[model samples]
Target chain A: MKKTSVFGPTTALAAMVANPLAAQDAVGIDDKVNQVFADLTGPFVSLIFAPFPGTSFPWIVMWLVIAATVFTLYFGFVQFRFFKHAVQLVKGDYSDPNDAGEVSHFQALATALSGTVGLGNIAGVAVAVGIGGPGATFWMILAGLLGMASKFTECTLGVKYRNEYEDGTVSGGPMYYISKGFNELGLPGGKILAVVFSIFCILGALGGGNMFQANQAHAQISGIVGDYPGWITGIIFAAVVFAVIVGGIKSIANVTEKVVPFMGILYVGAALVILIVNYDQIGWAFGQIFAGAFTGLGVAGGMVGALIQGFKRAAFSNEAGVGSAAIAHSAVRTKEPITEGFVSLLEPLIDTVVICTMTALVIVISQQMIINPETGSYMLNEAGTAIATVDGNSGVALTSAAFASGISWFPYVLAIAVVLFAFSTMISWSYYGLKAWTYLFGESKTSELVFKVIFCVFIVIGAAASLGPVIDFSDAAIFAMAVVNIFCLYFLMKLVKTELSSYAARLDSGEIKKFTH
Target chain B: MTVKLVVGLDGTETGDRALAFAKDLASKIDASELIAIYVIEWSPFTFQTADENAKRHLRREEEIELATSRIVEPAVSALRKAGFNARGIVRHGDVAETLDKLTVENEGSQIIVGRASADGFTKRMFGSSTQNLVMHASVPVTVVG
Candidate 1:
């Protein structure tokens, strides 16, 4: 008798295993798919995440860190300066009564937040803390803070360069801005950049956005139900995703807007409850994070190791530098593109700084890190890194353990959250992937339907296999989007700055009308 | 030959003002009739299951019917009361584009709309339908204050 599935499709299959034919067949399929995935994605993942020659640091992490630091300084800390304005934009205070766009500022922000705020906050943060020690929380906070300006810069352009159709619909993203803005600037590389971006966006949509989510969801579910095949879980996940996308992106945006807030409150509420219950250890947990951030508790890379893990995982969590958020934010119905920029800064704050930190604190306070009480240091392995509670089990499993320690039933709750988070991310990414697909192929019913089907298929592929290399590749592919997107950002930052300053002046003079309910 | 004039209405008091102005102008210009189009604000943003998405077309038809009876019918009747040969129509979606399209399709020479006013917070957010007509309408547009 095995533990029954608490979350998704595999549960019933696991429970009624007296009929093992279906389950047994799925196991063979899972292994074959896993092998294929490993062979196909192995080279790509290695190339993408490869550390600098003779160094432990992966270049992609460095690429994001340097870009974030540059934007933070170059924009003069616009994230902080414009933080108040972003709040007002989200509140719909600065919106023109007659402005035309697809959705409200709040709706756009929520839609964008839904895509980035999912599994990474739950699972990615656990991995970061597990590998980099609690100190990773510190760098993650810093990375999230810097990532805000990157979000602001890209989203403002998402609206400014958006193509408005005769029907009053719009399409925007890195693809639009890269081509249109560069043409305006008389720069020659815009078309190439735009094309390159579309390619990555599609691959990323399949890998990181869809398959990674399906993989993680399958991983969590299978963990609970004593080694069941994943294809059943994959089929169910794919079916749900296809159902939503059938309504198109608006329906996706609408669902995301509602789900983002609900999940945010639910996850945060649970975190707050855990923190309150462990009120006495909250300060002590912070001390561990702060100390570990500096000392790394004898971790091999020491200070730099924690920083690298924190920044990498944080980038994954908030996806600020990645331009997918711009696609969602661009639909906002506002005359001022800068307002969307202001609103988007909040996404990273909520996703990484707040949510990721909560998970880290919970894990740290759970005593899962095995602290050296006398020296107030984490017990590290021979490799000089703190080990995960469940050996070889990282991501959501570690976080689940941390939470279940505080509340015995939390793992079940976490399983549900992971699935929901996975679903939310999948639907949102499907829209993102479809947009890119349409951009390359042209927007037609047949083309849109084609992309949607392909996306669903990948969901099945993701679910049916424990393709470690494939998930790694998709994760890298997601960051790969940042590589291309940030390149475009460098070219467009001046335009973004011009828009920001002009809007600021007009706001100062009260030229921009306000509607207060 | 009879000249045609398009009057964009919302069934609000302000929309009635635009209709009155259009009627007066039509008489001055010797236009034979007025076409009054009320544009319902419908956004593409919807959060619905796939089943709902498939049913959305039906839902939109219902909205169009509801808007015609509740909002457009009375506006048209009021125009007839004023001794104007007028036809009423109801449309949904992007306000500016739909009204603009109606003008072209109906062969209306010009469009008359009330100037957008910030009389309420709700009105403020939807924006001035008149302003949109002025900017986007295919024909010349009059924004009656």
Candidate 2:
């Protein structure tokens, strides 16, 4: 007898059995859409993600890394110097009682954190470990640390140049800073750069920020709930997203904001449990990660391969130099723009350093990577890729398998977390995309609705098919945003430094006072 | 001797009854004053999305206006017209804490609040604002049931 499952759509099952052609056609659609998207996005994706000459390293990854390194140097390692101060600011120790109505630094950080700390941590880290080998973990941490400076530089500009309307509402991001900061510096083409950034922000919102999230969520759900058409999940997600963004159902967003943090805590708790269970193997896992980072553990491309993957996944996960987080941080209620900058640095730390590391460690300690004793590296197959215990799986599936290996029921909890994370990310990105959309098209009800509808449609497309081209395009679009943003950051960074020094002088002079409650 | 009374208002009938009780108590005492306070329960730590967070300042302003004009000021005006020295205060925080703080700041001899109906399961599980004020206030609290 055929197994009955609630997750299996009865109509889809009956149709597939009654006519095998229908099943074949459904797969064909998934592939055909992927093929068409690949053709359309290929040139752009190649251009943005092009590898550096004679290396597998993508130039975009290098762009982000170099920018992070520059910011780290330019700011004199502010991420390290003021790390303690950043925590105090977030704790509201420096906040004045008079600033009660304004958005708190903690609120800004949490909003930005929700946007960055999603599938990238759960799935992106898995792909990094799966392909780049355990050694990638070291570079990932390094990138996250360096990325903190990048966040500080951009977010400071975001707050400084934010637009405050008469009604007391605000709008800010790279667009404002690029145009305004450039003008302030007497630089030409600031407006043009800002326009270019808005274009990429819209595309990225639809692709990486919306579709990629939707796609991964579907992948995790289908992995657990039995096979069903991706469109079903896509449509459901799209509908709920539409209702929240367009229908003005704030309750959903409120509920998501309340729930996602709990889910994040649950995810970390589960990871801690798994680590405790493998307590004896913790040191061994760290050794594998550190050794694999340098030696490559027989993984493809050796040490360099691990480095590229580590840097790539870390940038994708934390989104430090990408400038998306600055949009969220700009809303912070602080008289000193650098306070938001200080607070914003914590996003990469929590997202990549803390959460992504947790994911990577779990995968490493799960016994997924078989060591080749002869080579003192990971065992590889004929395909020249390290063999994973879970064959033919990557992304959240790999992470899920790792967690399930620890506690058999962790996959269910992981599935719920993935959906919530995806949903919350979409909500935050919808606002981000809407801001970009309005910046280009002007803020109007009609313009907002148009962008919201377009965003929801992409969610469906992302869910309906296996998206190789879409994923590539999404990565490209986001990197393209960095290209414009990091360039502008170079121009505006001096201004941010000026703001920082002024703030420091004021604090030293006791012009800025800390409050205790 | 002069007596000062503080009335916690929620803009509801229960609050009106509490204000009336406080008003009568003030009238009976020579050289007494009434302080009507309305607190909008709020915490900065609650999770808010970027959109909501962006508009938080505007929302806070609107809430203060609403509580002052619609709840606190109107009630205080009526008390003032009745020949009593009355002033209203609006703040954001835990209801019980804000009221207790107001009482302390105003140098009130007594605090008065309506017995709010059990709001929900959580409110019932934890005591309501009046119950909390009665338990923790620095001054004598009068529950105008």
Candidate 3:
């Protein structure tokens, strides 16, 4: 075990763990767990993250970027062209009172945004800027803009091919679209592709959605309260999640829905305050972003490195093409399938373009990152991690340090935000996973319970142990979903184009009435 | 002159008293009518999960159906049987806004609504729907105690 810091908030439990005897046992268990998962998931992780031959770029990132670009062109820059209409749709300006029973465009957008706008904005951007330098922010914004097109295509397809049950509930996602959309096009492998996507979705929910979130939440809490066994936090979290998901305690869920958004606002508000305070540095920060994009600020691989990190994190952050947002959007009540698509494109804008940019700016402006005056690049430690002025901080800690620089009490606020973000993410992903589970096993109460139990168990494991391979596998599973989703989107692009054209014609003809001015 | 009194019903004893008062007032006036309106209070502002959002429309529909059947229909039929021209309206929105909007739509000259005991903290702090309607309704509002 690493030596406890002199000024660390070490409780009795922490002190006991710091004792050599207890420390050895804890390390032994962690090592054993890591060894098992790493060995098991090693090949799959390598295959997923494997770089292109003679380059550091992961092919999956290229896959998403290429697909997003194609959709942008094919849809005639739909994200930009329909931007105003999208806002109108969200504002209930075009929503007929007769169509009031289904999910509002605003609610669907909010639900989808909640799922995407969590740790990726907070920690993921920090990681991107820390390693890839300020240049990553520029590429992140560009990638986010392109991602809106991807969101447009998938969500349009999702609503076009959703399953409406007798009881009024509906389900849709890449799995539904891939299967039904391909079948409609007289393709044979739609079912198989959908099954593959579902399997990946379930795993992604467990690893990235559950485990990674639990791990990060624990990290943030421990940073504030004191170091202790992570299982203590995990068990407490699992109990609460269980009460919400299994026990059907809607009060907890309701409070969370209200609270999470407030937390999001608080986070953005804090970022804005910090940015406004450093009014002079705003220009210099943008200069760093622009300069670093091309020149790399002396970082390795420079521009290319920055581009790769930006694209990867933006894709992960907004999840524009991952098809998860499609499931949420599919439930909206609209006569035209294309309206939800318009509404969904704003998700990437809000998540990556607005929120993620705030985080990147705060990190860039705060100057927590140590730069070598001579080399004009970030100073690196022995492990090659970007050494912050705080010393040894990275990820959320680096972000915390950056925010704490401006507001001394920001870390406490950040800790609350992180925990809330993690909790909300887990709740959202549990629903996503349950949907996938029911699709595969046929929607039975027992099957859903099984998945929820397994998910909560994984949360405990995630918090208790540091399993790198497991997290890697979780990330791979999510991108693996993108791999399947984007490929299917290529075949189904024509359907979306036709729908958009028809909707546009009717809209121009005033067949679709605006309910509000 | 035809006087249309829009009465807000909540399927409570207080609502019955409001309807009875509206009926008595209409009886005393020539060519008067009673429009029983039940507002299923709802706001689009509340955040929901994907699953809950998916089912929101159905829930709203169910609420409308229930209110029409249980509250508005029964009261309107009774008013009709008592020899008053009556109709029922049910909508999902804020109570004061929906009631006032329904009144204006029907060209109502007066709004009659039951004033339930406003005991809750939020009600005390922000004022009840009856208070809101009396303060802001376009037509005259009668708060039946």
Q: Chain B TM per candidate, please?
A: 0.81, 0.94, 0.95
> How many residue pairs clash per model?
3, 3, 2
Candidate 3 per-residue C-alpha lDDT over A324-416 given as tens digits, one digit per residue, 9 for 90 to 100: 888878888888889999999999999999998999999989998888888777676666644445466677778888999899998888789
- Top TM-score model: 3
What would the per-residue lDDT of candidate 1 be over residues B52-73, giving only the tens digit for each residue?
A: 3223434556766787888778
Over the full model, what C-alpha lDDT does candidate 2 score relative to the true structure?
A: 0.84
Q: Model 2 residue B2 lDDT? A: 70
Q: What would the per-residue lDDT of candidate 1 be over residues A1-517, giving only the tens digit for each residue?
A: 0001123344335533745776576656656766887788878778878999987788888888788888889888989988887787776676553432235676677667767777778877887788888889999999999988888888999989987765445678889999999998889989888888888898888887887778667767767776655678889988777767764445554655566567667778888888999999999888878887998875557788889889888776787778888887777666788888888888888888998899899888887766666965555655555553534445666778788877888788777777777787777777778778888999898998999999999998877655556666677777778888998889888999899789889988998867642
Residue lDDT tens for model 2, A1-517: 0000112233334434555786788667757877898889899999997888888788988999999999999988999998998999999899875466568898899899888877778878887888889889999999999999999999999999989887878899999999999999999999999999999998888887887777767766766676667678889999999988899788988999999999998999999999998899999999988998898887888899999889988887888888888899898888889999999999989988999899999999987766666766777656766455546556667888899898899888888988899889888888888888999998788998999999999998877665667766876888899999998999889998898888888978998878854
- CAPRI classification of candidate 3: medium
DockQ of 3: 0.67
lDDT of 2 at A489: 95
Give each model a TM-score: 0.77, 0.93, 0.94
**Which ranges of candidate 2 are over 4 A from the true structure?**
A1-39, A373-376, A390-393, B1-4, B31-33, B105-109, B138-140
For this target, which candidate reaches the highest DockQ against the unseen true structure?
Answer: 2
Off by over 4 Å in 1: A1-41, A99-102, A247-260, A381-385, A388-393, B1-70, B75-145
- What is the iRMSD of the candidate numbered 3? 1.5
True contacts kept of each: 0.04, 0.75, 0.65
lDDT of each: 0.76, 0.84, 0.84
Candidate 3: residue A116 Cα off by (Å): 1.0
Question: Considering lDDT, where higher is better, how would the candidates rank from best to worst?
Answer: 2, 3, 1
